[model samples]
Target: MAVRVLSIDAAGIDLAGVALSRLEASLRKQAGDPDACVADFFDLAAGSGAGGVPSALLFTRGHDGRPLLSIAKALRQLA
Candidate 1:
């Protein structure tokens, strides 16, 4: 498995109290893991935001020798 990395920007979404909820939903829908947990899979890192918007860096390594980067890239493409 290879490591995967992704950066998300939540600047103008104005989701109010649903930011984390929305992110979890997106991760579940896109990653095909209904039980997706940020702490379980991703390593949170500092991310640069565009226009000073909030941003986050998510990184993870694939399990069982799979490439996490490819998985993340594929999911993004599908999304």
Candidate 2:
């Protein structure tokens, strides 16, 4: 299987969040799944500095195996 990876490099800028949100939206449209989790597409994810915030939000799993927020959701709060 092909391994998909994602890397977030946020410098604490609103543009970063906006970009992430847009990316997730595009992925959803391409996959024909509006409710898709962006993280589900990636086998590996990494980030640094402020980027870590979104990386965690996208990849981190909760008790029920869900993240705290989606990329679009985090955009509103993070950006």
Candidate 3:
């Protein structure tokens, strides 16, 4: 299985916890695997309480440990 890293901003809401949870569930559902971990990073400029922007990095492992798509780049497409 490949590792998928999804980075999301924590400033939009209290997404650090829930975002990763949702991502993990979604990935597991889609790939039928339960191998996923989340790494949260804080960006000093964008954070409210802190000096950085809180970001979440979700790592998901698929059957080949590779991502079928890059969710982060895909999000840019929405823009």
Global Cα RMSD, each model: 10.7, 2.0, 12.1
lDDT of 2 at 20: 72
| TM-score of each candidate structure, all chains considered together | 0.33, 0.78, 0.35
By lDDT, the candidates rank as: 2, 1, 3
**Model 2 residue 67 CA deviation in Å:** 3.5
- CA deviation > 4 Å runs, candidate 1: 1-16, 45-79
Candidate 3 lDDT by residue in tens digits, 14-77: 4444554566567667666554332212111123342122331122235975433333432343
Where in model 3 is the C-alpha error above 4 Å? 1-5, 38-79
Give the Å shift of residue 67 in candidate 3: 14
lDDT of 2 by residue, 1-78 (tens): 898988888676476777777878888899999777778678888887878777877887779876667887766666
Single out the weakest 10-residue window by summed lDDT for candidate 1.
50-59
lDDT of 3 at 13: 40
Instruction: Report the poorest 10 consecutive residues by lDDT, candidate 3.
Output: 37-46
Residue 2 error, candidate 2, Å: 2.9
> Deviation in angstroms for 8 in model 1?
12
- Candidate 3, residue 21: how far the Cα is off, in Å: 0.6
